[model samples]
Target chain A: MTETRISRRFAECAAAGRPALVTFVTAGDPDLETSFEILKALPKAGADVVELGMPFSDPMADGPAIQAAGQRALHGGQTLAKTLDMVRRFREIDAATPIVLMGYYNPIYVFGSERFVVAAKAAGVDGLIIVDLPPEADDELCLPALAAGLNFIRLATPTTDDARLPAVLANTSGFVYYVSITGITGSATPNATRVAEAVGRIKRHTALPVAVGFGVRDAATAAAIGRDADGVVVGSALVAAIAASLDADGRATAKTVPAVAALVGDLASGVRTARVGAR
Target chain B: MNTTPNSLRNGPDDRGFFGIYGGRFVAETLMPLILELEQAYEDARNDPSFKAELANLSTHYAGRPSALYYAERLTEWCREKTGGKFGAEIWFKREELNHTGSHKINNCLGQILLARRMGKTRIIAETGAGQHGVASATVSARFGLPCMVYMGAVDVERQKPNVFRMKLLGAEVTPVTSGAGTLKDAMNEALRDWVTNVENTYYLIGTAAGPHPYPAMVRDFQSVIGTETKEQFFAAKGRLPDAIVACIGGGSNAIGLFHPFLDDPSVAICGVEAGGHGIDVENGHAASMTGGRPGVLHGNRTYLLQDGDGQILEGHSISAGLDYPGVGPEHSWLRDTGRVTYVPATDKEALDAFQICSRLEGIIPALEPSHALAQVLKMAPTMDKSKSIVMCLSGRGDKDVFSVAGHLGETM
Candidate 1:
């Protein structure tokens, strides 16, 4: 496989002796225009990689923060096409920042898998993180997305045992998302000691970079996790920041983009200095 | 054109797919647990001790082999409506007479036993109309395990009596207020709970839906309804009934009754979906097969009521039990393969049947199965008296009497 933008960015971050700061935001959140502003500002705000959430009506695995963000985006008339359009527009200004579209499978299934892959590739999407499609459902969307030359990143949860880690990692690319906690997003706080041990175990099996997410909230937690992980994914916290900055009617205020950007900037600094004076 | 499969019962192949419908479409955190469940269920299926224990509970605890009643008065009423030119004999698989007053206990007992076998100490379930909640609570109480039931807030108000019954049985009922505050939301909450409490908790799904093994496992446990009906009807008439009908809410009772007779080409099967006002009304009915298309939700790819963006639409129905946006995955495959016919019955028609069956047979039917009774009322009068139709009386009307009275504008 050719070296994609995601792998290249991870390598660059590794060369700097720091983990990559992976930031997530729901596309078209609050409204379409404001979401685009947030997406465009993420790179400058120190986001090494971006995960754009494709809003779906029923996000079973998500907690309240991300779920409400998706609802707001959907309420703003965001569709899979519009989400891709946001990515396409983002690519116009910044071609080096890797963007991954993350959500459940139904939206893509409804968009027609073959058609979605072509459209997503054309939109300059670097990877995908479909929460519901496991390795058992490889033929459904995973294989097709890979065939279209898009990285299909698979999640390796704490529950993924030694026997099962191989299957989860087989077709995975870009990076292995190690869910630090065994719960939904923004729920329980993960133990840093356990997370480091898991990252080491996964690294022993493959040469791929491992990113830890789920329950990562602030700069302190990001630094604690990023010390061992190749990438630190902070999603619910950023979406929560967006929620906190919204108006009472749930409309986006002037501070929405700034709030999210400030949080990402803090998390990015923490991730950059995580390996400092250690090793 | 769909070719008929040689055997309809052999489905959900090794990977838990009924054709291309069912699979483990879940989070990576839940994948290993689902695979463990699949293996555990397989072992229990082949173990005679497990079979014997379930059979014992079915007979002694749940009161299995619920009567196959001849519904003579209902049959006569239909004949009178048709001037004796039609009206086939009407029979009912009296599942409402079970211990928990519904067919839900059959599957609950089996699942609870499996939970115990898996050393899971905590039990959780999601319910729409509370029949499954009551059944889950009853089984949890029986096994001395802590139980939690997630119900939609709307259903909580409508199904007050059942809510109280679950509480009386020592189970915690959490009303989910998300989405439309209905079954789908409750299911989403339950999935979240299971994902959060993965270690010692077992999600006892209430229907033949959800991911791979659940659809197949629930179907197997509930299959006793059809197995008993087949034998009883054979003994009563020395042959099988010509037709069978049941309401579809995640299609548990319907699949249970339909699975045992799928190979019998001589018998016809029909599933009735809840049409709140009518299917033509947007988002006004729960007829996933009739008005919806294939989409993945609640862990399986099936026919779902969704919009152009693949966002699931909240389905409406007078009966809370039937108010889910998606049907079971096996039903989706069956609909695609033409093995069974799916039809919709509006609220008005079901209400009319609800009153008619109550007056004629003195049996007030639950609104869920009243939809099925509505279809039987339609099909029975068009057939000859020599033929017979069996409908699953899946639940009693006691739980729905309050809602029925309110709908009828009568103060209770």
Candidate 2:
């Protein structure tokens, strides 16, 4: 596979002796124009990699924050076709930062898998993190995404034991998303000690960079994760920030972009300061 | 009793798709847990002791082989309504006679036993009409596990008696207020709970729906209805019925009755879906087969009541149990394969059947299965008198009496 922007960015972060800061935002949250502004501002605000959420009506794995964000996005008339359009527009100015499309598989399945993968690739998507497709069902999406020259990232949870590590890491690329907590997103704080160990355990099986997410809310938590991992992923926290910055009518206030960018800026600083062992 | 080879039951294939339906369309966090569940169900199915235990519970606790009683009066009424032109023999595979007053106990009993075997101490279920909730509560009480049932708030008001029954059975009933406050929302909430408590919780899906092993596993458990009906029908009449019918709401009881009869080519099968007011009117019915397209929801691909953009639309039905937007994936496959005929029954037609059955046969059927009786009321009188029809009286109507009274504009 070609060295994509995701791999290059991780390598650059490794050379700088810091973990890459990964940020997540739901596409078309509040409105498409405001969401695009948030997306364009994220890179300068210090997000090394970006994951744009494709909103679906039912997000089974999400907590209230992300679920509500998706509802807002869908209510604002966001569709998969439009989400790809956002990526195309974002690529016009910034071409180096890797963009990952993350969400459930139903929307893609509805759009037709081959058609979605082709459209996503043409729209300048760097990778994918389809939450529902397991290794056991790799033929469904993971292998096809990988075949389309896009990185198919897989997640390893606390419940994923040593016996299941090989299967989890078998076809994974770009990175291994280590879900730090056992529960849903933003539900609780993860144990840094346990996360460090889980990252180490996953590294033993694959050469891919490991990014810890799901409960890494603030800078301190990101720094704690950065101390050992190759990437620090902050999703629900950023989504919650977007939600908090909304006005009474749930529309984007003047502070929406700035609030999200400020949070990303602080998290980037936290990731940069923390020292990690060299790969 | 001429049984052909079982060539039709081999579906869902290996990846859980019943001919382009029923895949694990959930989030990745639930993937490991879903895999673990698939494995556990496989082990349980292969274990003879597990089978023995489920069989014991079905017979001793749930009152298995619920009698197949010939509804002579209902048959006569059909003849009278048809101006004595014709009348098909009618029989009820009396699932309402089972403990807890519904066929839902068959699946709950099987699942709770599996839960015990898997060492899960907490049981979570989503109920529409509250029969599944009551059944889940009963099983949880019997198994000594803490239980939480997600129910739509609209249903909570409509089926208060079953709600009280669940609470009395020591299960907490959580009212879900999202997405039309019906079965679909309740299922969404239950899935959220399962994702939150994946370690110690076992989600007891009531119907033969959801992702892979669930559609297959729940059907295997509920297949007792068809297996017993087959043996009992032969014993009583020395022949299989010419036709079999059951109501479809996520299609548990219907699949249960239809599965064992799939190989019997001579035995025609029909599944009746609720047509709320009417399928012709906008947003009027829960008749997925008639008015819906194939889509994914609550983990499986099935015919769903959805808008043009694939957004799942809330299904309308007087019967809370039949108010879900999607049918079972297996039923979708069956409808495509021409193995089973799926039809719809409107609210007025079902209500009429409800009263007709109550007054004529002295049997008050649940609103869900009353849809089947409504179709039968139209179809049975047209068939020759030599023909026989067996319908699954899936539940008793005690929980539905108040809803029926309100619909009839009659005060208690």
Q: Give the alpha-carbon lDDT of every model.
A: 0.95, 0.90
Interface RMSD after interface superposition, each candidate:
0.6, 2.0
- How many clashing residue pairs, candidate 1? 0
Regions of model 1 farther than 4 Å from truth: B1-5
Q: Write out the backbone clash pairs for model 2.
A: A131-B28
DockQ of candidate 1, scored on C-alphas against the true complex (2 decimals):
0.90
Candidate 1 per-residue C-alpha lDDT over A81-130 given as tens digits, one digit per residue, 9 for 90 to 100: 99999999999999999999999999999999999999999999999999
Instruction: Put down candidate 2 lDDT per residue, B139-241, tens digits, no spaces.
Output: 9999899999999999999999999999999999999887678998899889988877888999999999997889998898888999999999999889999
* Model 2 ranges with Cα > 4 A deviation: A276-279, B1-6, B281-283
TM-score: model 2 vs. ground truth: 0.96
- Tell me what fraction of the real C-alpha contacts between chains A and B each candidate also makes: 0.91, 0.38
DockQ for each model? 0.90, 0.47
Candidate achieving the largest lDDT: 1
Q: In candidate 1, residue B45 scores what lDDT?
A: 91
